[model samples]
Structures are given as structure tokens and as C-alpha cells.
Target chain A: MAEKDGDENKVAKQDQLPADKTQTVDSTSGTTQDASHEVQQELVPSDARELEVVDVREGAFGVRGTGDTSGYGGLTRPVMMPGAAQPPFGGWFDEVHDRLQTLTDSHDDRVIEKVVVDRGELTFFIRRHALLEVVTHLRNDDALRFEFCSSISGVHFPHESGRELHVVYHLLSMTHRRRIRLEVTCPDDDPHVPSVVSIYPTADWHERETWDFFGIQFDGHPALTRILMPDDWQGHPQRKDYPLGGIPVEYKGGTIPSPEHRRSYS
Target chain B: MTTVNDPYAGTTESTEGPVFTVTGQDWDSVDASVVEGDRIVVNMGPQHPSTHGVLRLVLEIDGETVRDARPGIGYLHTGIEKNMEFRTWTQGVTFCTRMDYVAPFSNEAAYVAAVEKLLEIEDQVPEKAKIIRVLMLELNRISSHLVCIATGGMEIGALTVMTCGFRDRELILDCFEMISGLRMNHAYFRPGGVAQDLPAGAIEKLHSTVRLLKERLPEYAALCNANPIFKGRLKGVGHLDLAGCLALGLSGPVLRATGYDWDLRRTQPYWGYETYDFDVVTWDEPDAYGRFRVRLEEMWQSLRIVEQATERLAVMEGEPVMVADKKIAWPAQLSVGADGQGNSAEHIRHIMGESMEALIHHFKIVTEGFRVPAGQAYAAIEAPRGEIGCHAVSDGGTRPYRVHFRDPSFVNLQGTSVMSEGGMLSDVIVAIASIDPVMGGVDR
Candidate 1:
């Protein structure tokens, strides 16, 4: 199940870090791989100063061609993401990174995939296989004791192609009085990431919540049942593909459309 | 040996004896299971009064001693996070404010602060606006704690404690209504600042309310602080040490009760909280009684912050509460009209006649809302319950890409099993009340 094909599933493992960190993976190459490939692409930064265009959305209100009576038919915008940060990340972020690196340096491949310092916060993107080890170190290490796992939030980006699901763990170190974010990604087809319940018992329900919403299965979760949704519910309601269910409201003369059917701006 | 055939009970005949398969029948009627072992499973509620807001506890008890306890939530799940994805950034506040109904200001503050951080306008948010936000949040803390004490006291059959708690809480609600124009679910805290400035006579009302609360606050101390029965019911019950709290990721009064002086307001100050003076109330005992004392004392600290804010608000009259940014700040300034509340006449005139550009901006802002740069930021605040954090992701659009709240109640609720297991079945209510998990937040 963990086997990978050449080039197609290269980004899936920690060993295949893009040599040119600024390279962008085309969506077609990542999407065409088989389910067994377990393709996962790390979000590579394109430029140091500019925003990396993740997707180029065309025609406002999701309309294309002559159907768009609204004059925004020709308009297009690039959905951008901030690039990875350079070394010497201001404040204690550098020390945490150095300590985490020192602990995981013996490994064949780097555990820290990419570091993103955005909006006065530090985010460390980690590989799926190394997530448990990294989290345990963060908790047990006296130097970096992120003792409290604040919450686990799952983000499903269908546009990310190979890596369609992302799990972010917000950790708070009360001992050091610092906070850092750890993010791990997995392919939508094989959404199996290691569960950190062994290290942090509080992640029990949070992992359940992430699974309930995004359907990202934690491989070793003792009882990974839906927490906030009914057990018999069909689809993960928070996924981008799932429809926002609502009924149309009827006024005296005309019926007002539901939210999904209403005119959209983006 | 019974003559009547019971259709409800699915019974089958075996060589040794007649086996009864329990299906939708009364659990007490299942004698075969009781014979196998002394332990019996009981479902407390998705509807019981003491469970507090649709939280169902599945308890496996052996002769009134709980062998195991598991919480069954999601009965109150409203999918507010999913709903916020479809709405504009400014409109997202309304959805999140309703998450923890008791402390709506904390929800709004965390969300709005996160949005401002994503916008990189955290510093640009007016000083007066931060003060008001802090003031409203402190007031909300008092109200939320009052409800916790009131409902917690009611669960233990203390009628007077419940009545007095609510009575004092009503005064705080009046202050909230006087300023935000609503008693609860006040979507007053916006992205740039608050929805509007403090209304006329709001200061006087706050002063009077604060004075009255100070007078009546001691009633709770006199009533429950030394009462032997209250002490008997709460002391040493739901005991979770500092290690247990750290492992389970508990915070607020629950963690503070363990004698840890960790508070987001003190440790990681936001919205100029470091400038204020207040103690992080804590207790050495890690139990229901300790949590109760922590909450009771935290209310006094919150009142101190509230009083300081009221003094600052009196002098900073006529200062702009919203940010100066034309692109981000809300376009309309509301006023009380002859009919009801409506857009200010000056703003209306400026948009209608003064400039066409202003008119376009007004239309654009009101209809589509302002856009935030693409990125994600997590803003955590010390809410009345615990650490309430908002993780907001934007795709450089008017609508949010994804928004998730790390509601303290939700995380703290995970400790129910750990706290209640191996204890008397009666103490389950005390354990839950001490954690104070708001189902609205837990199931959001």
C-alpha cells in the first residue's frame, strides 16, 4: 500500500524534496497517478518576493463564455500562497527549528519539509511518515516541549491535486511560553496519517473531528468514529466537493434560490 | 415461565436456557446481561437536565461506581464552520459568535483578531477599538462564569445559588445590551474594530452595573465558599492533576485550578491586554471545588479589567473605534432614526451625493465585502472557559477558504472520561460542570 511509482509518486515521500525549492508541480501530472501511488506534493515556493499562484480562477461568479451576463467575464485572478521563509527566522522560531533539526538529523531524509513564517507565526511542514516522531520529540524534549496540542484542524484543498488533504496541528509550549504549528499532508485517495494520541491523549477527539469533517483517516486511531456528525452520515460535509445543502425559500411572488444556487463572487 | 408473549423482546431458545436478545427494550429488563457481570451500561442524556446542553454520557457502572465513562456529542452540531466558508469575511463574525453562546465576545474577538493578523493590520486597529474589545470580552467573562456557577450550583440542588447567580448575571447582560444592543450573540466585534461606538449613557450604566455586581458578588462567597455540604459535594471530586491537564490539553480555570498560573492574557497578550492590571486566578487543589474557586475569583479579576476599561473609555470620547482603512473598515455608521436604527444621515448623504467613488465603495463593501490576503493565521485568546483559538485561512477572496475554531470546551470535554472514570456515578455531574463544556462549542 505504501509503494510509489517513479516521477508520479516522487513527491509522496520525504526522500523526494524538489531540488529547486521554487519549482511548481503541474496539477495534471499529480492528478493522473493511480490511487496506489499515494501521490503527495509538498507546496514548493515559486518566488521569494512574489505570491505563488496555486490556481488561476477565471471569469467572476464561476461563469464562463457567453453565459456570464455580468461584465466580469474577462477578469481572472491568481490564487497565491506565501513562499517558504529563509534561515534566521526571527525570535525563538530559529532555536526550535535548530533543536528539531538536531534531533531528526540522523534520519536518512529531512523531517522538516518546508518552513513557512507568515503573519508573525511559524509553521513547519512535516512529512506524513515522520509526523509521529516529530510530535513525540516536540512533547518529550526538554528544549522544545510543546506539551499541549491545542487542536487538530483538517483543510481539504481539492485544487492541490496530489495532496488534496492537509492536517494542521497547533501546539503550545507552556514550559517555554511559545507556540508553533506543524502541518502534514496526504493524498485524498490514501488519506492515512499517523495518529499522535499516544503522545497527546487530547488529540483523541480532535483526530475524530478531523476525520468526521475531511475523511482523513488516522491509521492507528483506536476508535476513529465521527464526533460532530452522525455516525450514519453519508459524506464528509466540510469537504470542498460536498454540496452546501439548503432549500430554496419561496416569497409571495418568486422563490429565492438557496446559497449554492445564488450568484457567487468567487 | 411467563404466559404473555412479549413482541418487543427478541427471544431465542437455547439448549441451556432461553436467551433474550435486547433490542430497543428497557435496559433494566435485560436480566441475562446483569447475571453475566455486575456492571451495567446506562445512557445519561442527550436530553437530561444535568448533563448540560445535549451532552450524552454513556456510563458503564458496577453497583453505582463508574467502571468507564464515554461522552457522546454531536447532538447540537450546527456546522457553523462549514457555513462560514460560504459567507464573506465580515459576515463570518455572525456565525462564529453563536458558537459558544455564553461568551460570544471571545469567539468574535479571536476570529476578528485572526482576520486582522492575516490582513497585517493588527497594529492599525485603533487603540480605542482594542480597549472596547477588551472591555466587552472582560464583561463577557463575568457573564459566562456566572452561568457556569449558576448551572453547576443548580445541578447539586442549590436553588438560592442558581437564582443569585442568574440575578447578578442579568446585570452584566444589561450592560452588554446597553453597549452592543443585544443581550447575547452580539456580533458587535468586527474585523477592523467593533460594530459601532459606545452609545451615550453607556458609561453611567456600566458604572452602576459594576457597583451593583461588587455589592452582590459576595453573596456567592457567603453562600457556597464555607458551606460544608457544598464542600462535601465538590471537594476532591473530578480531581485532575497538572500532569493530567497537560496530557489532556485542558486550559482556563481547569488548568489554573491545578495551581498552574498559565493564562493567554498573561503569557501571550493580545489586544493590549499586557497593559491592563489583573491577576491570573489559580488554586492548588485540582478538583471541581478548585475549578469553582478559580472561576469565582477570575470574575473579580475580570471586573477589575472592566473597571479600568470603563475609566479609559470615559476619557477617549469621540475617538474613532474602527480602523482608518477605507478598504477594510465597515462603510456604514449607524444611528437611531425616528423609525428605528438606520444608516447615519451624514454617511448616507456622503455616499448618495458627495462622491460617486464613495457610492461605489459603499455598494461594493456592503454587497461583496472586503478581501483578505491569502494565508492562514491562528489567534488564541484566554476565553472564560479556556484557550479559544481561531484558525482562519483565506484564498485572497471575500469568502473564507476554511475556518476552524479550537474551542476550549471541545478539547476540555475530552477529559470527561479521565475525570469521571473510577469515581462514584453521582460525581459525573460535578466533573462535567467543572469542565463546563458548552455543547454549542463542542459540537460546532
Candidate 2:
């Protein structure tokens, strides 16, 4: 987990580079192939050439080391995270991105780490320190009035090393009838992200639920306690490392194995 | 008058005239401190019928006016989202359907939409499937609102409204049972398309359901629209204006009641909802009574959508309802048989005897499920309660990496304090009912 921190900084620094420079790095790396990748490269400016390879997965199923007895024993795939999108994001995305950039550029240039346009949805990877600033601007700004924060979902990626825990906020501009996602990441040891309850009051319970499930502490949240689970429960059950604990089932003739022990493809 | 030696005797003689000790009850054991100094802390539910499904409210009242109201939930948390991580993407519909049990199809539609979006097959989904989805979702909207109005009315001592509301809801459930086999938690909507085509005579049944609900819906308007007692109970109660609603992220009827035409079907327009002819109901009162009227009017609008969908389905007979994708779509063509619902006879014979590759394809798809590309997608649909959104993240695996639902019940419940405070204590029930939160969805 500690070693993952250096890898996180490397990726962050690479993303911080200029778009044209990153394209040169990608071309030299020679990982950009396939028809869809080529089309995407032509469509998006160099910054959104190809998604970042998060993990090089081995085997067809999730299980490793002979637990996977399926015929796809030698299959391997690269799990890619969407890379940053450049200008002319198409439709309202470019406008929102530009407006947000112009408004927040005075405070911190690195606030918006990456802008990803994947599957016709726009996502902004906001810095943890500037999450509140970007969110408030999105909600209150005249051109960018994302007045409604529809959801705040926390996702845990234990394999990602330092930035293992992520929080994704879905904001809907009811006035503009547009939707956008803002994501923030924190290391598991220091899983502290500033709370948005001050801006969007609806985030009160959502932040608590994120804390309860992934143990991502939303700093400055009022009375953050277990909302769904019992107060005495231990460990965040939704984390990737947490076990899906189940007991054997008793039947008329014999007992059956728990769900995790059962024959599963993934 | 009874002897002390007798086991059932109650009276005993004392130094004064006679001292009688009363047991088997705690009528006199009121803790003075709890209700002391004109500030009373009252705990309502975890079991009470009126709290709407195990919702516990801790309210502090100062002489009939509620000073603070805090809603305690999670009595029904089955960790549906967490459990979805272990199941296949197609099987996720079943788990989420049970979240808001009353509005199961809405949950399925929202979840399946997210899955389809993640798979990048949103357009490949059959046109007929989208229509049927719209049909079932509208029908479910009616049923869910019926339950809300029935239970909300019952909580406030309107027995006639409860009976009438449920009486009409049964007709909708009958339509669901005919089409989906099971009435609730049908898991009828698959990721690529629906689980099966409409059963025989499903169109006629749906048409009749719309016709029947159209006639029955007006009875509610007549019953409570102008009734003095009903108005006295709900009017001017739980007043939350448009600003408060926007701030709290309230949606559906609660937000609409604040006079905002913000229905997602009109604003976001998914599943061809833009083509449907209907009106977004709004009430400017911004109170419990306004929410009731909004729900009442929305039911009529849902009926209109259902009517339009049924008319369209009448002509769309014999059309394929599932996606044409061989790898992603479920192989089974379901048909009801003497034994039970299972694979159709022709489909079974084709896979079992006709083609060797077909059998292998069936086994692989059913056992392993198809893999979705590595990505994340969020899909939101306007459910009966509010905006139910599903955020699905896939790690290029068969199973979901993480699935989270922003249940409107859970989010709207946050307004319990803001809505009910500074109002009469009795209006707290009115406030919660107006929100129409299903605790199962709230805790999920």
C-alpha cells in the first residue's frame, strides 16, 4: 500500500503535462492501437488519446492461481481508466469545462486534475483540496448552475495503491438540464475529503453513507455516524478487501457451501 | 373487599383507610424527566404502523409544536448495493428490485439502464423492449403512488381512501402478473432488454387497466380534494417551498408539489419518454395536501402514458423484445408451462438437440455472464418517490466492481428535520407520508 503512493504521483505528474507532450509520450510508448482507439485519437485532442492502464489483469475470472478452472486460463486484459479529455468536448461539456476552468483558474490551476468524456458522459477529476471550491462554483455560477447534487457514491479500488478510495458525485444542472460527475480520490490511510454539505446540504447523509461503507472520512461533516449499519459494526463492508461473508446452508440431506465457496465465474 | 391470601386479591389494608397496590401495568410510572420543563422527547416507531416501514423518528416537542425531528432508518438495510458486487450484471436487477418493494420495476429499469449504458449497448436494445419498459414503469408508477396514497391516507385515519386506493392498485398488479409472471421483484427488465416479450393478451389487459384507473382516479379527487376534514389535517402542514426543495435535493412529487415542472421524464427524457404525451403535475401549496394532490394528478398522467404505450404495443405485436446481441442477451426464451415458467419448448429443443454450439453458448452465457467494458455510468429515472439513480462501475469483469444507488428515499429523508420542525407534532406523520419514502430503499 505504501509503495503505491509513488506510482500515484507518477501518474498525476504525467497527467499534469501538456496535451501535445502527453501525445508524444503515448506515441513513443506504442500502446495506442485498435480501431476504436485510433478513432478516439483522431476525435479527441492528444490529451484524450487512450485511457490510462490501471491494472493488467490476468486470467478470465477474478480468481488467480488455478482457482479459475475455466477454459480461458491464458486470457489477459488491461483495465483502463478514462484519460483526460481536451477542448471541444462536444455539446455542453466544452462550455461547462471552459466556464469551470476560467472561474477556478485564479485559485489553483491544478484544481481540475483531468476531464474525461467517456460513453457520452463528462467527468471532472477534482483535487481533494479544491473539491468544495469546484462544487460550489458549479452549483452557484450563472453559466454553470448544477443546482442539484443527485448522488454521492464512494468506490474503493484497493489495487490502485495510494489513491485507493474514490468518491464520485453526480451533479445535475436542473436549470440547464445537463448532468456531470465530479470524482475525488484519497489514500486509504488519509481518506479525508472536504465535505460538500456546506454547499449542497443534500450531501449530509450521502457523505455519512460513504464514510460508513468505504470509511472515506468527509472532514467537517456534522455528526458523522453509521447510518445504514448498526453503530457497533466494525470495518467498512463495501471496500474491495472486505470479505463477502456467508455461512453454510442447512438442508434436508446435507449442508451447502457458502456463496463465496460456490462455483463462481467471477 | 378481597383477601390478601388470595392470589387474585387486589386490596390490602393500611394504616390510613386502605391501600391498594395496582400491578401488571405502568400507567403511573411516567418518567417525569423525559417530559419535564415543557420539552418532551417522544420516540415514534421502528414498529409503528404510521411511520411507513420501520422508520423511527426522535422528535422533541415543546407543547404540541415539534422543536426537532430526526428520522432513524436502516432497519431494512440488506446491503443490496454491496451484494451486487458479487452477482453478475444481469442478476443485479433482481437485487435492486427488492429495494423499493412497491416500485420494484422502477429500480429494475434504472439499474438495467445503467448496466446497458456501461455495456455501451444503449442503442442496440430493441425498440419494442423500450416501449414495454415504458409501459411497465408507468404501470409501476401508478401502483407505487397508489400504495403511497393508501398508506398515507390510512395513517391519517382515512379508511375509505386506503380501501379505494388499494382496490384500484390490484388492477395494475394483475397486469404485472400477466406480463412478468411474478407481481413484485419480477426482475423483468434485463440489461440488454426485457426478460421476455409481453404475454398473450397483455395489451388488452393493459388497455383495460388504464381504462379502469382513469375512472377510479377521479374518486380520490372527489374524496379528498375539497373535503374539510382531509384539508384540515393536511393543508398548511409540512410546508416546504421550492427553495427548500432545491436545497434538499427533493424530486418527484415532493418537488413538483412546490410548483416546479421538473419531472425527469420531461427533463431528461429516457426510454423514449419525450415522445409520450403526458403532463407534469404541479401544486403550488407546498404542503402535505399539495403532495397528495400532486400524487393524485400524477397517477392520471401515468395512466395517460400507459394508454399511449398500450396503444403502441397493440400494433407492435410479434416484434422482438430482447436485444439481437448473441453474446450479451440471455439465451432463455421464457414461456409459462404446466410446471412453471421456464425456457420455451422450441428454445429448449433448439439448444438441447439442434446445435452443439448453441448449448455451449447457453452454458457460458448463463454460468459466466458477458463481460462489460471497463467504465462507469450513472443512470437516473424518476421513480414514484423521487429521482432513483444507479452508479455502476465495471472493471472489465462479469460482475460489477461497485454498484451504488442514490435512493431518493434515503436522500429525501434528510428533509424530515427541515420540513416538520416548527409545525404541530401530529404533522410529522403528514410530512413523512408526503415524502412517501420506502424504508427498504432508504436503508439500501
Candidate 3:
């Protein structure tokens, strides 16, 4: 531990280099590229020319890369890959991706709705009814082995046409420092999703919280109790339709209703 | 009382029925009323001092042992998350800072980082601002850990340790007051940059305090760790193995205690944490004692980072802490009234008479705040407790579409039951305290 601290200290001290030494933008090119890479390659692709390797030391490298194609605006400087050789849990992301591909290939087109890749993390949007089967495949499939449910959070999209409530499940592979998000959406009136507590006992409270805030019921949860909000609290507090506050105090002859009391005409 | 099929039975026969019983019973008249066993329930707190806050635990006791313990939260809920929806983007900082009052800077930094991510303006944050943030956050981490150590000690019957912990923590709060102008919930960290630059003498004070803490920490460790009673009370109590912690999404020292080395600062760097040198302290014991030791060691590591960060701040003496982007950062040197409030008579007159464009722009920005492009982003930071993440969604509007905080205390608190389930009832207090949950952060 002390050795690690010492190495980090050395790196931090080296990082105190003058800002000018790290500056990449040149007046001539009007673009920033790795100064060290200029000698190794010639005529870099116009699109890829914006990639600037900010720092390169030891096994780690920081690159300021642009993502214009994915509609991801602005320059993103992801610390591409850490210095560690093995992904925290060996081959975590790779196994999940391969398993997901195999499952999607065998499943019906409607069962596997969409797959969106945001940066390195993958999100699979399956049909609400297929959530149980998909999650089961991910958990039980020897190759996939997404044994842990990192989080289960609910998102409300009021303006969306069909599915207004999105239940997002974050899965992590402890053996591999890999993560994937599983999203399933259902209409606001009937927000029911199959519970994963049967597979992972840790999902008990997370599912309860989702139920508490978004009013999404997880079938087969042992105790679907309110984890955060009061047991008798009215409505789903996180829903866009729910008002922010309900405290109302009338002073003198005038009356002032809290934010909750104000009617949502829409 | 009636006993059956036992050698040393109190009474073999009853007295109310047509049977012969003990000394007081008449022949042919005996009563047999067997006592049924039912579980006794005890409510531990919504106001109990030992509960740490308004936390209530309903325990089902079978004799002297606890059969089931259910935690009841939300007594301290203030609806801060819901309130964030009604405020402007910049105004949300004031609310987020209150969530983790012990380490307000972490909450502020996480919230602002999320906003900056949505705006895609993180890189544009000035160098000085990053250093200032690291400085404030490390100091906050130490202060927060001190509170945990103190309160945890108090919970474990170490009264003197509490005094030492609180006394050391006050020094950090004094530093906070100097920099942010408030002891707690300062709202010092804003979207584009810090609310203001570090005050004069803040670095000098931090240097002396860090040195003092480094010297004094060993005494604290000796006081708590070396004592036989303290060790006996904590050593093997409330053990949550590595698998249990990982399954429950535990982070910070609690997770580290279980032999997992996961620190967002090292794994996923932010706020120029990549430029700081520190260790992700860990222990394999995975017990209450292990957690206590990890937090104590973490304080020393935090002090090291503070020393180094303070040196870096000294180098960037007078650099602009706020971003140069006028669209994001408010202009410096705004004229103030005698009451020290902005929008004074002179300021408004100058803006209206001299720079009508500035007046119009200020009015528009102040009224609506800056609009973030429609997108979603999740930014995580290492708070004193664990991984504090902000998942923000924007719909190309001044108001955020959705803002959800993955508070570490909340996630870490989930592992409490896993830690205490099979342990003794007395172990429950140590287990809960080891997690060091601030209910404000959890229930936010």
C-alpha cells in the first residue's frame, strides 16, 4: 500500500509540469494531435486528427477524443484504459457482449428491441415482457455471468409516447471491472417488471426503492415495502406528475397552497 | 405454569380441571392453561440517542436474541431531491450541499460535475479550480471521517475518543469557514468552477493542521485500537465478507474493509484526482474492527493528499479559478451594495447605462440559467463514504429533465442488515456505526 502511495505521489509530482508543456493546440493546424505521434504516422485521417493524447506515461494514457458520429456532442477525454493489465474481473465486458449477441441472434426480433452503445458501456432495451427471460439468460448463462445487480433506478419520461417509465438495471461483473445497463420500459398505469431478487438477494432493497419512488411493482419480491419514502406517502414522489412539496400554511385571511396542492392542469 | 415430559418440571398437573395437581389443588378439580410462546417486538428509535439520528429499527426478539431487525428510514427526509427539480441549474448547488452536511463539498462537487458533464464543459474548468476542489474535498473527507470515528467510538462506549475526534474535526470546519464563508452547506462548489478562490492564509492553516493531525492520529489509534476492551468489543463483531459487500454495492472504507480496493479517484479519476497520490486503504478482516482501522488509515492518506494539493495550490497563486467562458462563468468584480448583496444601485445603473447588452444577457441568464443540450450523463466521485454518483438527464432546457444521485451512504447502508443478521444484538450498533451513514445523504 505504501509503495502504491509512493508511485502515485511520483506521478502527481510529475503532473505538476508547466501547463505549456501539455498544451496541444497549434495555431498552424487549428487542431490538437499527439505531438509524440506526429513522428510515427503521416497524413492522419481528417476525422481522427482531433484525437489528442494528453499524457502518456507507464501503462496509462489520457486521450482527448471526439465523438461526433454518435450525436455525443463535444470533445470527450476518457482515460481510455487504466494501467492495470487484467480488467478488474477477467474478461467481464467481453463475456457479457458476446453472450448478449448470441442471445439476441437466437431470440425473436421483437423480443430484443434495441441495443445502444454509449461510450464503452452497452445498454440493452428489451421488451417489458421479455425482461424475465433476458435477465435469466444473463444471470444463468455460463459465459455471461452477470451475478450482481449494481443498482435498479427508475426514470420517468412524461413526453414519451408509449413507455413513460424506464426501469434501468445496472449490472456489474465483480471479477471483471465491466458494467452493462439493462433498461425495460412500461406504461405509467401498469409498471410491472419481473423481480430479480430470486437470482440475487441483494436486489431486495433496490427493487423496493424503485417501487417506492416510481410505483413500479417488482413481482415475486419477498417484501415490496417502501424503503425510502414513508409507508403511507401518497403517489410516486419521483414521477413528473407529482408536485415537489405539499406543505400549506394559511396566514391571516390569505391562503397559500404548497407546490403539491397546486393543480397540474395538463 | 405447566410442564410435560420433564424430570424437573415445576408442575406436572394443572389446578383448574378435574385432576389432582400441586399442593394448592384439590382432588378431581384441576385447571390446565398452557402458556403459548409469541415473539416480543421492540422499537429501537425514531428518537433514541444511540440510533445516531432519527433512524428507527423494529426488532423481533426471541428471548434475549434478535430474530429479525427491520430498519425504518425517512424520518429525516426533507424532499431535497424533489426540490432540485424546481430550482434553476446553478441554484441546485445550494440544495445538494445540504444532503451530506458532514462533507458538503463532496455533494456539491458531485452535483456540479454532473451538470458540467451535461454541458460538456468539464475540460474547460480552469486548473486553479480543480486544485481548489481537490483541496476542499480532501479536507471535507478528513472532517467527515473524523465524525464517523468519533460517533462510532461514542456508539461503542469510548467517550474520550469522541472528544478527540470532534476537536480535530473543528479545525477542518474552521478552514471551511475561511474558504467558503460558511461552516457547513457552503455551496462553494458551483457548475463552471468554485464559487470563489481560496481565501488568503487558507493554505498556511491547512499545512499546519495537516501536520498536527499527522502527529495526533497515532495517539487516537493507540487509544482505541490498543485498548483490550475496545478490541474485544469490535474485533469479530458484524463481519460482512467480501461477497456480501460486493453484492450489496458497498463502497468506501466499508467495502475496502472487505479486501476490495475500489476508489473512484484511483479507478475513475475526476477533479484532477488523477494528479494526486494516495492509497486505497484496505483490510481483509471484513469486521467492525477492520473498518475502524481502515478509516483511521484513510485519514492519514487523506492528510497526505491534502499536503500535496496545498503545495500545488501554492504554485497556482493568482490564476483564475473560474472558467474563461463568459457564457458559463459569472463576470468577476461585480459591484456590491453596502449590504454586500449583488444587484446594487451602482451595479445595475452601470450595467443599464453603459452596457445594455450586458444587462440584457445578465437578465436572461439569471432568469433562466444556461440551457444544457438534450443528453444524459453519469458522473461518479469518491466521497468520504463511498461512490457518490450523479445521473443527470437534460432535455435541451434550463431545467434538468431528471437528476438522481446514487448516494454512497444509501448504497452502503444496504449492507448493514447483511452485516448484522446472524450477529448479536449488541453487534448491530457497531455494524451500523462502521458504515457511518448520514441519514441526510441516504434519504436525500
Candidate that beats the other on lDDT, 1 or 3, i.e. the better one: 1
Which candidate number maximizes DockQ?
1
Segments of candidate 3 deviating more than 4 angstroms:
A1-98, A104-111, A118-121, A136-148, A246-266, B1-38, B332-353
Off by over 4 Å in 2: A1-48, A60-63, A66-75, A106-109, A250-256, A263-266, B1-36
Reference-based lDDT, each prediction: 0.86, 0.84, 0.71
What is each candidate's DockQ, to 2 decimals?
0.71, 0.57, 0.14
Q: Better model by TM-score, 1 or 3? A: 1
Residue B89's lDDT in candidate 1: 92
Candidate with best lDDT? 1
Q: After superposition, which runs of candidate 1 have C-alpha atoms over 4 Å from their true positions?
A: A1-51, A69-71, A106-109, A252-254, B1-36
lDDT per residue for candidate 1 within A6-72, as digits (tens), equals 1243333212323333234333243222323323333422323223445557778756576776678
* Ranking, lDDT, top scorer first: 1, 2, 3
Task: Locate the minimum summed-lDDT window of 10 residues in model 1 chain A.
Answer: A1-10
- Compare candidates 2 and 3 on lDDT and give the better one: 2
Could you give the C-alpha RMSD of every candidate to the true structure, in order shown? 6.7, 9.0, 15.3
Q: Per-residue error at B18 for model 2, in Å? A: 47
- DockQ-based class of model 1: medium
Model 1, range B1-444, lDDT digits (tens) per residue?
Answer: 343343324355533233333223465455463245677678889899999899988887899899889899999999899999888899999999999999999999989989999999988999999999999999999999999999999998998989998998999999898788889988999999999999999999999999998998888999999999999999999999999998999999999999999999999999899999999999999999999999999999999999999999999999999999999999998888888778999999998998999999998887788889888999999999999999999998888999999999999998899999999998999999999989998888
How many residue pairs clash in model 2? 0
